[model samples]
Target: MTLPAPLTGVVPPVCTPLTPEGEVDVPSLLGLVDHLVTGGVDALFVLGSSSEAAHLTDSQRRLVVRTVVAHVAGRLPVLAGAIDMTTPRVLDHVAYVVEAGADAVVVTAPFYTRTHPAEIARHYRLVAGRSPVPVIAYDIPVSVHTKLSAELVLELAADGTLAGLKDSSGDLAGFRAVVTGARARAGITGFSALTGSELVVDSALALGADGAVPGLANVDPEGYVRLDRLCRAGDWDAARAEQERLCALYGMTGVGDRARMGASSSGLGAFKAALYLRGVIACPATAQPQVPLSEGEVERVGKHLAAAGLL
Candidate 1:
């Protein structure tokens, strides 16, 4: 299916379910996809940070895209993350994901080396030039080490280099700039400005964001979907209430001991643990190098789930 011009609503960055040996668990993955679909997500994003894309090998990434694209079967748009350290490698990922039937590709700025704004512009242009599907800029400074300035994003949007943006920078002001610019700018129709923030979905939507890409939605897709509906319905009170509930559930991310693991391990491990406790995924094992949550951490996750009424 062709991606919606201004893709809107909840688009979960799916978690990659892994076996005990760290192989992709296809059955669990498909079951998670079914859970999301049944819960009414607008779209699915695979091979993203939440999916542990950096940990997955080339073949694993390809399998993820193919499996999701085929299972989705055009029911909802699938946006695959063509994430790499440079443009050429990103282009290779773009080719395979598009060939696998992804509706669009999400990419981050070049990492591992310092880059200029001009270089970032060139990177997007190069990828867009070669991609068959739409290209959405993923402004995740925390991962890429370079925050995409609002000016650069608008410039890219104006020239048709970017179809949309996934702002995970935790900078609402910057995100608002993109949303307002997309609306006010001429010749920039159908450009989506989606927030990757789970805690502020209502606020982002209020500021005219097109939608959200909350990772927590993987554990409770119905809640996020409901939150999206409430916001769109102009029910601020209900939306805020729902958003707060999800936020409380998000506390699960902190259950892992900080001294033993980095934020990725704690965050991703919490997500996977919640999925396991909720029966969405078979195992809560995270990728290598990132520590898995201890049994106590998993129990804490269960408490968060139970408090959120997910248990």
Candidate 2:
């Protein structure tokens, strides 16, 4: 199916369910997809930060994209992350995901090596030139160590070098600048501005963002879906209430002890733990090198789910 111009609504970065041995749990993955689809997500994003893309091997990433694209079967647009260290490697991922049937590819600034704004621009231009599907710029300064400026984003949007932006930078002022620019700029139409923040979907949408790619939605897609609808329906009071509920639920991301693991472990572990507690996935095990949540942390996740009426 053709992706909607300015794609909107809840687009969860679907979690990559793993077995005890850390291999992709195909059945569990498919079941999770069914869960999200049934919960009314407008689209699916695979191999994203929430999916533990950094930990998966190249073949595993390909398998993830292929499986999701095949399972979704065009019911909704599927976006795949082509995250890598540099331009050439990212383009390689772009080829693989596009061949696997991703409707659009999400990319970030080149990482691990020092870069300039000019280099970032060049990188995006190169990728956009070769990619068959639409290319959405992913501004994740926390991970990539480079913030995509609103000016660069607007310039790219005006010239057709970018089709959308998925901002996880946690900088609403900057996000709003891109959103406003995308709307105000001439010769730029259907340029989607999606917030990747789980805590501020209402604010993002209220500021004219097209949609959200909240990672927490993997655990409770219906909640995010309801939030999106309430926002779109212009029920500010209800939307604020729903957003606050989800924010409280978002507390589950801190279940893991910081001394024992990194933020990725805590956040992603909490998400998978919530899924397992909710009976969405068979196992809550995260990928290797990342610390697994202890029973106590899992209990905390369960408590959060119960508080949110999810369990």
- Candidate topping lDDT: 1
Worst 10 residues of 2 by lDDT: 1-10
Model 1 stretches astray by more than 4 angstroms: none
Q: Candidate 1's C-alpha lDDT?
A: 0.96
Per-residue CA lDDT of model 1 for 216-281, tens digit only, reads 999999999999999999999999999999999999999988898999999999999999988988
Question: Candidate 2 lDDT, tens digit per residue, 1-311?
Answer: 77799899999999999999999999999999999999999999998999999999999999999999999999999999999999999999999999999999999999999999999999999999999999999999999899999999999999999999999999999999999999888999999999999999999999999999999999989999999999999999999999999999999998899998999999999999999988989999999999999999999999999999998
Please state every model's RMSD to the true fold in angstroms.
0.5, 0.6
Cα TM-score of candidate 1: 0.99
Runs in model 2 deviating more than 4 A are none
Q: What C-alpha lDDT, on a 0 to 100 scale, does residue 48 get in candidate 2?
A: 91
Clashes of 2: 0
